[model samples]
Target: MSAPKPIRSIVIVGGGTAGWMAAAALSRLVRTGVSVTLVESDAIATIGVGEATIPPIRNFNGLLGIDENDFLSKTQGTIKLGIDFIDWTREGHRYTHPFGEFGFDIEGVKFHHYWRKLYAEGKASWIEDYNLCATAQKLGRYTTPVADPASVLSRLTYAYQFDASLYAAYLRAYAEARGVVRTEGKVVDVLLRSEDGHVDAIALEGDRRITGELFIDCTGFRGLLIKGALKTGFESWKHWLQCDRAWAVPSANPGREITPYTRSTARRAGWQWRIPLQHRVGNGYVYCSDDISDDEAAATLMANLDGEPLRDPMLIRFEAGRRKLAWNRNVVALGLASGFVEPLESTSIHMIQTGVSKLMALLPDRDFSPVERDEYNRQTQIQMEQVRDFVILHYHANERTDGDLWRRVREMDIPETLQRKIDLFRNRGRFFRYDDELFADSSWIAVLLGQNVMPAGWDSLADAVDPALVRQRLDRIREVFRRAAEAMPRHEDWLARNCPAPTASVTRKTA
Candidate 1:
């Protein structure tokens, strides 16, 4: 006996980054004879605010056979080495959470342990000063990692800041060129089968009924297919993650030294993000609407801009949570429809990419197995929860005393998993990654120490290495990072020379 083949007709609703990403990846990876159609309305606009990204985006681009320079040029992209958090810990404090490791560990013990011992004795400096990525980012430098494993530059990792609409448009063309059929219309109706209550097809405004064996819901926050039709429950994380609204707007670049890092500056009520792109800078404030009015939040954002405002900031409301099941019956939700965890770390696009990749991994058959669906939902839950905990750490672990928002966040109870990690780090300066979590050990250590969460004791292994040798190793690493950063080119110069956005003559119009 052989397993039954999955359905051939796949329909994706909506055409932003999520929809086009799903269509493009499916068209490129799925077997031949399978039809992929995406329907989106011209009147429907996407939230184009998520411009900054982490390093995993490179893997997603690589999966689609995308040329790095071509994609960067098409999207008016610029390099982002990591994020610089200002005023999060306390007033007059700043820190850089770089992408790569800070320093090398010896005998399998983390390097933070040795650094803790030095700091306790008042002999060491900031941990981030030893990170190549952090140093390069702070200096407005950009360069791909060197090939030599022995070089400190080899450990540097980076992502990008680009126009989200342009990225979607880029992927749209890529998918269309690869045989994806795109339908233009608003999804007015979703038809479900009576026998199993699974989504069977969707009807457009003109009564044009399109049928498909499997449906992908990329309908933004509406969740038209997954929650609207299938009634998948949502797990509200408001208690843990409380910022429920955001205001985004673009501004003219300040023409200041353009560093290769995103800036997240803490405000009285929320945090304001400054993301530098080649064309313009992206800025926004994420705050709990209850603590601050929309007008107040907008004003706070406008008042904090590095440059003059280019447009009236747009407000986006959201819930902090995830769908109980990302994949339900014959429908799988992607992007905002699936759930939102806020863009604190710019994980919105990455989450969409991960959702699509998971669907592809569990590519189902016509007879959707409970086994496969359960596994997909289970994994999705774990990943989202892990990310949720990480995001919560920024808020809960803070030492800010600015206002009600900061006081509340600082006192709120956090998830046990995050608490455990914090306790472990504070106790022994030790950190461990479980189940291949997204944020690595270096990230945890950077954020933790940056916020003044110092460990009480050093790792036992640090005792084995001579204290003088540890100091020498630390000094050597810092010098290597400084030299490497000095050798890199300016971020703006690199983008302009390597990947310039397409002109009107060569650009594709969004149909």
Candidate 2:
């Protein structure tokens, strides 16, 4: 047997958040004499509506040695504790899917179990009352989580809301500074090797060619190399997801206190997202073209802005699914080229981050072993399916009677994986996390209860804890969270003091 040769060069195609993120992360390889090059055309536009993220983004930035405050200021970013879902369960109802856990577990059992028993006895409040992040978000407050495990504030977790284009630009600077070469040209053709059909080179306009041992496709939905040349197919989940179009626009800041959370309002045909940044608010209406026309979707978005529109609504079209194989032969696809599952839960940017992390973990040699590629694809598939099921839950579990879209989704069948979780929770508020699932037990509990999916019974284990003790502990947790939220600075004030953007013109408003 011969020793495997190490990969010498990596070529990344495209330059939005995905391309730049891959380039930035892989730039570390330059230290080992491996060349990393990214090709993107200045003329190409990116689908930059992925302005919201989950908490894992903090880890990604930390890995890159980025200062949180500096990155926030540069990207006109604002903290996001969670999402406020409006009218998803039914009209005139609202709930929050907070980032952190609910009250601490009692006697090694989940907190929700005890809360359920208390609620049944009319002695408990909403689940959000016991969560620090949700309480702070409701009060328009902001604070970093404390490191001490004994502190109640230590339970808080958060992500960020920012201008996606600015974030990509920030990452581009970071990658370039780390010696990643950026080429400004559109790939016209993908040349392949005759013997193995592996990507050999990419030909840009004016006959420029760039070659690499490994190729990464970040070419958005076109999949220029992964699909266009390699013929890797996509697995569509439109039957379950349904929403296929969106109209995204930016709006001027309303000069109100910037809430430290994202808001998702349920519309007739789809949903509307409102993400607050330091400089402006990013707004969008994601809808199914079959249920609503583009003009109607755009009109709905325009009519609902908190401030004047900053630009004409840009239309985006997409289906919900993943590539059949994220890694195929010598090429790996990230971002839209890899797959898209809508941005309902703000998972788009996180998906890219996960892809970059996985590629780095399973990076192949010049020989391109099938073992490495298979493991990468397997993990990618599981993650994508998990996300798909989670997103579908938002739609499938809705109780709104105003629109056909909601009614249809509610009656439609969901994946067994999600159905199993729903069944388990509905039975006794029992929930379990799957292998490396992105959403934790807290997230599942939040959304499930938020949508009015009440369990038929309380956990038998929770019955072991005395009712009086449960009530006392729950009340104390609520009071502590309330006081902590009150003591924190207002979100807008915190931004002004810690990381105000140069373009920000914030106006304080009483919360």
Candidate 3:
């Protein structure tokens, strides 16, 4: 006769970006008469390596009622217009995978259709010319989008490059201010209910047993709660992902105009990531363990840095996989505890946000309904698998013959979903987004074309359009993007004037 009451006590095990993000989002929705406590240890170290993010992160921040400028300043963040992929297509080729739409659709047909017609007639320009973010990134320019539909600024989307540890600290203050409790100690044991085998509470090092109606595991690759307690299985994707070990380090900024994008350069055995923050640059070499030794990987990472290393390159070992079930019994796993896909596409933080969001949508009661867990796991499976395929496309679809790593990846068998997408595009540059997945059409186009996967034929409808008119329209689109990008302020100059990070007493200075 009455609506079901939500769970009252929520316990978050572990802390870092994942733990605090769950706390912050929950604090907003479950403010009154609900207890949310987080348990973390000073001795346990956080990976703190996911510095770059994709565009969806902005939406998560907006939903949390966070100001972009404040968040940027606190995290010492920099704008990320897109990612610059170097040597991906071949030994000497490069490409830009920008954030927004390529151009406007005309007469109920995609804009790329018309451009394809012009290409066939030998009159069209490069695809990058029509992309605002690519042009702006090339010139180190950045500007916020406007609400006006008629302007090219309307579609400009961007993300951020920040220090992951600082972001966790910032969110900690926010969550604590909103009444989320913080417990400092290591978890010694997990207690499960005898009746349903659900986790009831965790025992801390001080012999303190804290009980809760629900639990969230943010324990990085260890999977203490999801795997250790509930025994969720893992599905490895190493064959497609290839790279499993990474050596990360921070270096002095090269001071080369501070471009508004992340750069991923293909290497002899793996790839190097260059993420430019406001004060310094974050660099890492991710390589396959079988192809190269840890010593070789570390040296390769250190030798390629643009500036002197701030510290020794930290070694991180990971398996490219996903938890078979993200939610089991009364415990839900967030962040690395759930699973990992390498940081190639910057999907780490985004995955954590999505997990918390989906939990809130299907927020359960003390009764622990199996139906909700089933649906949550189903959705999570779809999201992760889709992302996995996208990441694999970058490695398996390459034209590089550089070394064993590249050669093996190029010849590896790919998932059917990605293979179908590649085949469709290769036959004709046609890509369709399914069920509003994470990456959109423009993302696929960028990587496909960037890796030299050209369409063998154009759409038949594209041929119906007049060639002269197509060329004229295509030229206009490129010019509009060029003019819009030129009007923007330089990325470094804009940050200094609008959202500069504060200088800290410890760690590093905010440039």
CA lDDT of every candidate: 0.86, 0.93, 0.88
Give a tens-digit lDDT track for model 1, residues 1-511: 7878867899999989899989989996445788999999999989989898999999999988899999988797878889999999998899988999878987787788888889889878988888889888887787778879987778889998888999999999999998899998878988999999998889999888889988999999999999889999999999877889999999987766556789999888889999877667899999988799999999899988988898889989999999999999999899999899989888999998888888988888999988878988888888899899888888888888787888887898888999999998889887778877988888888888888888999878789988898899999988888888888877766666678665411221111
lDDT for each residue of candidate 3 in 1-511, tens digit (9 for 90 to 100) = 6578779999999999999999999997556678999999999999998999999998889988899999988998999999999998788888999999888777667777777667666788778888899999998888878889877798899999999999999999999999999999999999999999999889999789989999999999988889988898999998888789999999988756677899999988899999988778899999998888999889888999998898988999999999999998898999999889899899999999999999999999888879999999999999999999999989988878778988888888899999999999999788877856999988998888888788887778776767777777888888889988988888887887778887621122133
Q: What stretches of model 1 exceed 4 Å from their correct place?
A: 29-31, 502-511
Error of 3 at 494 (Å): 0.4
Write down the TM-score for model 2. 0.99
Q: Identify the runs in model 2 with alpha carbons over 4 angstroms from their true place.
A: none
Candidate ranking (lDDT, best to worst): 2, 3, 1
Clashing pairs in 2: none
What is the C-alpha lDDT profile of model 2 across 310-355, one tens digit per residue?
A: 9899999898888999999999999999999999899989989999
Worst 10 residues of 3 by lDDT: 502-511
**TM-score on alpha carbons, each prediction:** 0.97, 0.99, 0.97
